[model samples]
Structures are given as structure tokens and as C-alpha cells.
Target: HKGQELVMADIPGLIAGAAEGVGIGDRFLGHIERCRVLLHLVDASLPGPVEQWRVVREELAAYGGGLENKPEILALSKVDLVTPQALAAKKRALEKASGQHIYTVSAATKQGVEPVLDKLMEIAGRAQAMKVESDKSWSPI
Candidate 1:
């Protein structure tokens, strides 16, 4: 475990019309506005994992508020529930669609979680460094 501290919040699910007050609605979407990076956890055991990833992305983009532009990490969760072959296939598909690496993980079995956390820490550290540098550049007028 790294010494860096990271704060994370689990927002409600985003549906097709989340931006239009559908499902849990996008009221909480703004909570992520200040987040430097977003971790999108998609269920690998679900049918059409890629489609599910796209739906969430569309919701974020539609909601605007800079959420769409923030860096994102795609995590394929529930990997234990699916076969290795299936997991590999879905991970590849998601990576291709997202143009980023997909971290396969199983929360129940604690499988493949460390890599995801490690990556998150790395990204968060960089973001924090940038924020510090930006703050140092400001001065009272």
C-alpha cells in the first residue's frame, strides 16, 4: 500500500437519460466535476460490457461540466463471475472502444484489485502535483 491518500465517492448509477433526470438522475454528476480522474467500473459478467461502457460515457459527455474531459480509467469488475476467456474478450473489447487499458478485477475475490489501485494512486499523485504547482503560481494582487 502506498502512503498517498485518495478520496473516492460512489455516485449513483447513470442511465441513458441521467442528464434529463432519469434513473437516479444527474444531480450527483456534479460531485465529480472537481475530480482529476474517474474510474469507470463496468461489470464484465454482464452482457454487452462495451455497450454499458459507452452508455456511461455518453451520459458524462452529455452532462458536460468538464466531466467528459477528465482522465478516466476503465475497470472491468466481477471478473471472477466470468470465465477467463470471457474476461479476456471483454477486456479487449472495452480497451479497443475506450482507447485505454482495462483493469480486470473481482472485488469479491480480491483479484486484480491491486493493479487498479496502484494506477489510481499514480494518476492521483500526478494530479495533486499539478494542483500544487498551479497554486504556487498564484499571488495576491
Candidate 2:
């Protein structure tokens, strides 16, 4: 718990046709263009969580505003509703599908939430450090 602060914004839900100006459209994609990382919260309790993840990824790629290239953390929400076996299965499936670590969290119980936040902060800190380094002009004083 260092003295680092991470800011997160809540954007509108993206639909299947969001890239085509459907269901809130891709207008909000620009809002996160500069963001160093993205937390993609997926409902694990529902069916086809992997498919849902792909749909969002597709929309981001279609929008084409650097969103598709941003680092993303896949978070599986509502794990409490599913059994341990089911949760593990979904997590593995999602991990294989996205090729990224899958964080399981239950907002209702606050389970596995802190680790996600900590990971995000760690990523943001690194990104900030890189930005600072790149922003500096080498001065041989």
C-alpha cells in the first residue's frame, strides 16, 4: 500500500454493434485512448463469458483508437454465484481465450477485489514511470 493513486473511470457498456454506432456507439472509446491499462469486468455467472469478452475485444479493435492495443486486465465478476469448479473452469477458459491473467472477484462480498486493484496500481505506476522517463529531454548539464 504505497502512496500511489490510480484513477479509474466508468464508461458505458459496449454492445455487439458498438463500433457501428449502436448501443451508445463508439463515442466513449476516445475517453480511454490515453489510458495505460483497461480492466475488463466480465460476468462469470452468465453463460458464454468468453464470447462476451471477444465481442468487447472486437468492438475495441473495430473502433481503432489504440484501444485494441492497450493493456487489458480480464476480471471475472460475480464468482460467488458459481461453484468453485465452475469458476475455475470459466477462469481457465477466459485465460486461454484472452491469453491474460484472469482475476476473479465478487463485488458483493469484496472477494479478490484488492488484488485486482493492487495489480492495476502496479501497472499504472510502471506506465507513469515510463512516461516520465520519455518526457524528459536528455540534458548534459
Candidate 3:
């Protein structure tokens, strides 16, 4: 077994019409509401990173029910396939696209994992800090 005590499921990739019971959409999206954060792993080498990003964004937004509000860290996976210069460029593009710090990682090579993990931990810390800062309802956004 993996060392982690908790399990996270990778649901079927959300498709168009998922919210309307098209192709296991409801069942797949049901779990997203419970998550505190979402690591949006996108393939950076795709033809149009921004366009692909919007497709996913549109799918989630159309899903409705506040799912769109979930805090997310945008990440581009499979960096090892590209040259270093290309990787940096892709990272910049994704960061600009998502309006968040973008991480380029290759899970296979273990490159860039630590920084990505650090960002996730940093976000968690900020969430805790927010709780301690004010009892009144204040959104992180």
C-alpha cells in the first residue's frame, strides 16, 4: 500500500454536459465539493494551454453549485518531455493563464515536486492563518 493514510480518487475526467447527467458527471463532481483545495494538473504540451484550460473552466463553471469557488493551484505536469527553456515558457504561460503561481513538474523524474508540495503547504498554512486572524466570515479571495 502507498504510505499515505488518506485516499484521493481521480474521477473520470469531466466532460461536456457532465452537470446534466451526461456520462457520470454528477457522480464524479459530487466529491469535488468536499475538497479543501484542488491541484489542477494540466498537460503543458497541449496545442493550446489556455484554450484547454478554459474548456475545463467552463465545464466546472457550468457544473454550478459553488464548485467554481474551490481554491486551486494550477500545475503543468510532464515537464521532462520538454526542453528546459520550453518548460519555463510553459510555466509562465500557465501562471498567466490561471492567475496563480504555476508549477511545472514531472512526477516520473521527481523534478519540481518539492516546490509544488511547498506551495500546497503554504496555502494550507494561509488557510489556518485566516482562521486565526478573524472569526468573522472572510473569504480567501
lDDT of candidate 1 over 1-141, digit per residue (tens): 577688988876688989777876588887888788899999888999989989989999999897888888889999999998988899888888889888989899999889998988888889889999999999998
Ranking by TM-score: 1, 2, 3
Question: Candidate 3: misplaced stretches above 4 Å?
Answer: 1-7, 125-141
Q: Could you give candidate 3's per-residue lDDT for residues 1-141 as a string of tens digits?
A: 123232345756676777777888778788887665667778766656666667667777888867788777787888777777877777777778778777778888988787777666666567656767886676777
Q: For every candidate structure, what is the RMSD over all alpha carbons to the true structure, in angstroms?
A: 1.1, 2.5, 5.4
C-alpha TM-score for every candidate: 0.94, 0.91, 0.75
| CA error at residue 115 for candidate 2, angstroms | 0.8
Whole-model Cα lDDT of every candidate shown, in order? 0.87, 0.88, 0.72
Error of 2 at 36 (Å): 1.5
Q: Cα lDDT for residue 85, model 2?
A: 96
After best superposition, candidate 1 residue 27: deviation in angstroms?
A: 1.2
Give the residue spans of candidate 2 off by over 4 A: 138-141
- Please say which candidate is ahead in lDDT: 1 or 2: 2
Question: Model 2, range 47-114, lDDT digits (tens) per residue?
Answer: 99999899999999998977888888889999999999999999999999889999999999999999
Better of 1 and 2 by TM-score: 1
